[model samples]
Target: MNATTVSRLTSFAPAAISVLAIEGPRTLEFISKCWQPNQGSSVLPTNRIRFGFTKATDNQPRFGCNESIVVCRTNHERVELHCHGGKQASEKILETLSSLGAMVIPWNQEPCLLARDPIEQEAMEDLVHANSIRSTAILLDQMRGALSRELKRIEQLNANGKLQEAVDCILQLRQRFAIGKHLIHPWSVVLAGPPNVGKSSLLNRMLGYDRAIVHEQAGTTRDSLMERTSFDGWPIDLTDGAGVRLASEASDPIEIAGIDLTLQKAREADCVLLMVDPFSGWTNSHDRIYQETQGKRILVRSKADLQKATSVPPSLLFDAQVETSVMTGEGILELQSAIVAALVPEAPDSGIAIPFRTRHIELLNRLIGL
Candidate 1:
């Protein structure tokens, strides 16, 4: 008989639990050879779970966990093995099973057995690897045919020759694609400014902990520090770049490398938090740094607690700017809201149809043409 193919169906990172699926014509045979039931005979019911230990090729306990795992033969061709969710633990279990002749692959490399339709399939596929809860919810919404229902109505409108209404609907839906695409990937938000301007302070305040170092010294940070955190339930990668300094002000070679990374992060960032020490107000240096961010920037005035109105220039203005005082914890919430607004200002109404994958977007674009 052919070997059963095994694939991990859960995240590889350490978690509370991990699941692996084995499917093939010989899945039952493979399980019969390796699975040792705790209290009953080796015969497994089609739909019931049997608490057991998997044996190595030499017939020794493979998992040998403090608590044994439960195995289920879901059907004639499929079996599922669930175990503790550590990288090494799960990998060891998989390795043990593989030694007895099971082909191993990632979850996406294997087709989902229970997906009911195309929408469900896509949602299931995306949901499995989704890095954030928001992405999971969005995928679940799509699985309920959220996008399908909207497309159906659009198709009907096209059939009725109501071209104007259809065009308007398509335009509205098209606007949501960018937001949807970022649901899984996360938008990169870079904190950039001159040294001691409180870029790191803002980052720390927003994250509710001191992830970045805050000091009075210039060029204190010479490396980019990044963290992935959720804002208003949406995922975002917060990048704290090294402070931007004038060519003569660059402290050393390390600072130069850090400055290079700062510029690179600002250029690549989906949203740039361009900070200025309001105590000193807006200056020519701030303006020069602002120019480097181009269109993808949000101006922020830091140290509002030590505000000096005269230090601020009258002509200082930005399309997106907020006053923040990390010491007093003011405007931090507003800053978060502004970041979300800058990244994905408009989320679809709850339960509304929205494309969750590139394939769905492509099809919607085709319909827009029609």
Candidate 2:
């Protein structure tokens, strides 16, 4: 082949060979010999068609076998074949292509096939095993050019020599992306408080099922019970820990282990929901837990329906409170909305690109610092 033809051959060889393409005046005739209609009347030279074929037996071609093959032609210049989607069939087709002197390439290296942009690629990877609809949507949106647009904008600004403005925009977007990471991935939210504060009930309510057993008995949930759920389009890993309490002789070693685990989880959580029984008011233990939680705390007053009025009073105990009743479902929606608002603050603006990975975040942080 001449150099020009060789380049063309190289460009189209991989995909064409994989699909068993044939190129010659007699290509259609060759295909017709091996092709037998399985679902349609005839295989057209200009359209894609499926059929079946078998080895010749006693001077007769097998009409139909266990599998069907699809054939198509493009503008009379190339013919394509799609065999059964099985290992053996694919191998046989590949062998046939090889015999025809067609070049073969791995599927990933085929450039003629549609390719996803970087953001789209990342989004596809993110959504492959997404745990929530919200996460899926976020990935889909990102894949659909959200990140590309932002990066393009930055590039355009940089090309224009608007260094300060470009840097500012990137910095802001980087911050938003940091928060968006938690939304796209599962975030730990530890439910902790004194014993019998309905932490387990709240956990079950959030999960929309009895994932964690609840009882009137204190310390019924002697260990941490983890349930996965989504809140406000963010994947939340909810953990109902054994209520924080002073260790006693009656406490099982397992229960003590659970408390230790709870404290560990508390330290690692992105947010902490400190449950308090409104009827009993906050105690010293609650204060201790709250102090330990520092500012990563959202005060959730459980059993709100049992109160005289379904409202949080302006007391030190009620400060920054979210009232909730697992039984009556009051304030659940509000609490969820509040949690989302407090956590994410706002949805990322359209065309704003944020890194979705910790590595990206660290790199961006270093970039900013420099």
Best by lDDT: 1
Q: lDDT for each of the candidates?
A: 0.78, 0.64
> Residue 139 of candidate 2: its Cα lDDT?
66
- TM-scores for all candidates: the values are 0.83, 0.70
lDDT of 1 by residue, 1-370 (tens): 6557899888866688888899888787777766678887988789898898755556435444533567888887888888778777678767767877789987765645444667666777777667777777887888888888888899999999997898888787778877778777888999988888898988889988999888887777889999988888888889997888777777588888998898888888888888888555566556666767764678888888986543444565555778899889888999898888877767667787777677877787798763
What digit string (tens of lDDT, one per residue) describes model 2 on residues 235-337?
A: 8888888777766533678777877778778877777887778555666656656656643567897898887442323443422468899989998888777
Off by over 4 Å in 1: 1-3, 55-67, 84-101, 113-122, 152-166, 248-256, 310-317
Go through the candidates in order and give the C-alpha RMSD of each one to the true structure: 3.5, 7.9
Worst lDDT 10-window in candidate 1: 59-68
The TM-score leader among the candidates is 1
